[model samples]
Target chain A: MNRLFLSAIFALSFFFMQPAAMAADIEINTPAISAIKNSMQARHNQLAPHYTSGAVGLTRDGLIAVRDAKAVPLKDRQSVNTLVAAENKDRNALYKEIAVANQNPQWESDIRNTFAQRWVEKAKAGWWYQTASGWVQK
Target chain B: MKQHLPATLLALSLASILSACVTINIYFPAAAAEKAADRLIDEVWQVKERTDTPEPAATESETK
Candidate 1:
C-alpha cells in the first residue's frame, strides 16, 4: 500500500511540473534577448554624443532642424543629410535588436510597450509624443 | 609570427563562437517622424524665446 501511494504521488508531481518546465522555455530565450538589447542601447549611446554635438548638425528630432538651428554656412546640406541617414539606420537597428532578444512574440510586444512608455517619459519639453488622445502636448 | 599562429587561430575560433549569438531587430526610421518633433520643438522654443510678463497691472491702469 505504501509503495502504491508513493507511485501515485510521483506521478502527480510529474504531471504538475510538466507545464512549469515547458513554460520556462519562454524565459530561456530572454537572457539572450536582453544581451542584444544592451548592446544595441550601447551602440545608440555611443552615437548620441556625436549626434548631439554639431558634428554634422543633427538635432534630437533629426538633421534639418539642426542644420537650421546650429550649422554654419561651411557645413553643407549634404552633411546634414548624411548624418540623418546614419541616425535612421542606427535607430532601426536598435528596434531590431530589441525584437530579436527572445523567440517568443509576446516578449517582443512587452519590450515595445516598455520602450514606448520610456520614450514618453524621457521626451524633452515641446517634444511631441503619442497619446491616447492623439498628438496633444507632451 | 610563427609562434603565435595557434593563438590567432584560437582567437578566431572564439570570435566565431561569440559572433554566432546575438538577437536584435532594427526599429523604424525615426527620421520619418522627426518633422513632427521639430514642429513641437519649434513651438516650445518660441515660447521660451518670448520671455514677457503678463503685465496685468499695466493693463488695469490703462483701463482705469
Candidate 2:
C-alpha cells in the first residue's frame, strides 16, 4: 500500500534524525562527567566566598584568576593564591575530561567557550567576570 | 509515464534525506552548548537566588 510505504519512510527518517538532535547538546550524566562535576562542586565552597568578596574572578578563557590580590588580607594572600591555582587546575582537567568523554577531544575549545559564556551569564550580580573587552561585574 | 513518476518521487525523497544529513553535519549547535554549560554551571554554583535587581555598579577598585 502507498500508505504503508510512506509510513515506513517517515519512521526511517525519524530514526536518523534523533541522533543529530541529541548530538547538539553535550551529555551531562555519564560516569566520567559526573566524576568531574563532583570535583568541581566540592571546590565551589572554597571559591564562593572569594567570588563574593572580590578576591578572585572568572577569566575569559574559562578559568579562575586572582582579580585583586589586595582584596584578600596579606596574611591570607598566599592561601588565596594556592586556592586559585588548585581551582584552575581542576577546571582545566574538567573541561579536558568532558571533551575526552565525549570521544571528541577536538571539541575541547568549543566546550571551553561554552563554559566561559555560561560562567559569565551565571555569575552573581556582584561577582566579576572577564569579557573580550575587559572584566565586568555581573 | 508511471515509471518516470516513481523515479521522480524516489529522487525527491533521496534529496530530502541527503539535505537532512548535511544540516546535521554543518550545524554549529551554539544554543545547545550554551544550555549544557548553564546546567553544569548552575549545579556547581548552587545558584539559590536570582540577582537581577538594579544596584549601583561595583566600583573599579572593588573589581580590580
Candidate 3:
C-alpha cells in the first residue's frame, strides 16, 4: 500500500510538471544571444540609410530584402545586397539563439514569427515593410 | 490500515483538485515572445523610446 501510494504521488508530480516543462520563456538571454544582438546593432548603422531610401524593407518572415533597387544608386546596389544578406543572417541567428537559450530549439519558428511582427511594429514612419498582400510603406 | 485509509483518501482528493486546475497549453507563450522580440528590436534598431508603447514589465518572470 505504501509503495502504491508513493508511486501515485510520483505520477501526480510528473503530470503537474510536464506542462510547465514544455512552456518556454521567450525573453531568456544568454551569451550567444548577447553576441548576436550586438552584431545586429552594429550592422544597423550601415542599413539605416537604405531603410530610409526604401531600398530595403523588413520581410514578412523576419528577414530584410531589397524592396526597390532603384531607390539605391547603381554603385551602392551591390553593397546594399550584401548588407541585406548579412542582416538576414544575423536575424536568423538571433531567432535560433533565443530558442536555444530557452532550451527549446523547436521554438525558433515562433520566435521568428514574433520578431517579424515586432520588426514591422517598431519600424519608423517612413520605412517600408511587407504585408501578406504585398509590400507596404510604414 | 484505517489510519492509512484517511491519508490515501485525502491525497487522492488533493490530486483530483489539482488535476482540474491543470490547463496544459503545450504551446509557447506568445505574449512573452512578443515582448522579448520587441526588447531585442529596440536594442538592435536603437530606436528612441516611444511614449505610445508600453514598457515591458521587467518584473514579469517566464510564463509557466
Candidate 4:
C-alpha cells in the first residue's frame, strides 16, 4: 500500500513538472526561425571585417551601427552604410519572424531585447558593443 | 476512511498542478529567451570553433 501511494505521488509530481518545463524553454527551431538564422549567418561574413576594424559596432537595441564612419575608406563609406542598413532591416525582420513563429507577435519586443543581451554577451574580444553607459570594447 | 484518503490526495494534487500551470504561463520567460538567442548567435558568429588566424586582406574588387 505504501509503495502504491509513493508511486502515485511521483506520477502526479511528474505530470505537474512537465508543463512548467515546457513553459520555461523558448523554441527557436521553427521553419521561419531557421530561414532567418541562415540569412543572418550569411550576413555575418560581410559584417565581420567592419566589426574587426571598429567601423561598426553592435547597438544596445539589437542592431548594428556604423560607429566610426572614417574607419572605412571615403570611397567605401557608401557601401558600408548600405551594409549596415541591410543588416538592421534583416535583424528587425528576424525578431518579428521569431515572434510570429511562436504564434505571439506581441512577443517581438521581448525577443529583440533578448537578442540585444545575447549579442553583447557573445561579442568577441576587441569588438565594440554598446552598453548602458556607452560603447565599450569587448 | 481508507477509501477517502486516495480521493483527497488526488484532489489536492490536481489543484496544485493547475495552479502551477497558471503561474508558469504568465511570465515572459526572459532567461530562456536570452539563452535561445545566445545559442543562435554563437552559431552565426562561429564563436567556439574559430581558429586564431588573420583575416584576408581586402581585395580591390571587394573595395570597389
Residue by residue across B1-64, what tens digits does model 2's lDDT show?
7746775697588669857765864554567768878888888877755335344476466655
Q: For residues A1-138, could you state the per-residue lDDT of candidate 2 as single tens digits?
A: 666666677777777777676666676678877877887888887788788888899998999999888888899999889888887887788778777765567778888888887898888879999878877788
Candidate 1: C-alpha lDDT: 0.40
**Candidate 4 C-alpha error for residue A76, in Å:** 1.2
Top lDDT: which candidate number? 4
TM-score of each: 0.32, 0.76, 0.74, 0.79
Candidate 1's DockQ is: 0.01
Candidate 4 backbone clash number: 0
Query: For model 3, how does the per-residue alpha-carbon lDDT over A69-111 read when each residue is reduced to its tens digit?
Result: 9999999999999988888888888899888777668889988
Model 2 TM-score on a 0 to 1 scale: 0.76
Order of candidates by DockQ, top first?
A: 4, 2, 3, 1
Best model per TM-score? 4
lDDT of 2 at A122: 81
Candidate 3 residues lying further than 4 Å off, grouped into runs, are: A1-24, B1-25, B49-64
- In TM-score terms, candidate 3 sits at 0.74
Error of 3 at A76 (Å): 1.1
Fnat of candidates, each listed: 0.00, 0.53, 0.65, 0.70
- Please give the distance, in angstroms, between residue A102's alpha carbon in candidate 1 and its true position after superposition: 2.7
> How close is chain A of candidate 1 to the true chain A, as a TM-score?
0.39
TM-score-superior candidate, 1 or 4:
4
Please count the clashing residue pairs in each candidate, in the order shown: 11, 1, 0, 0
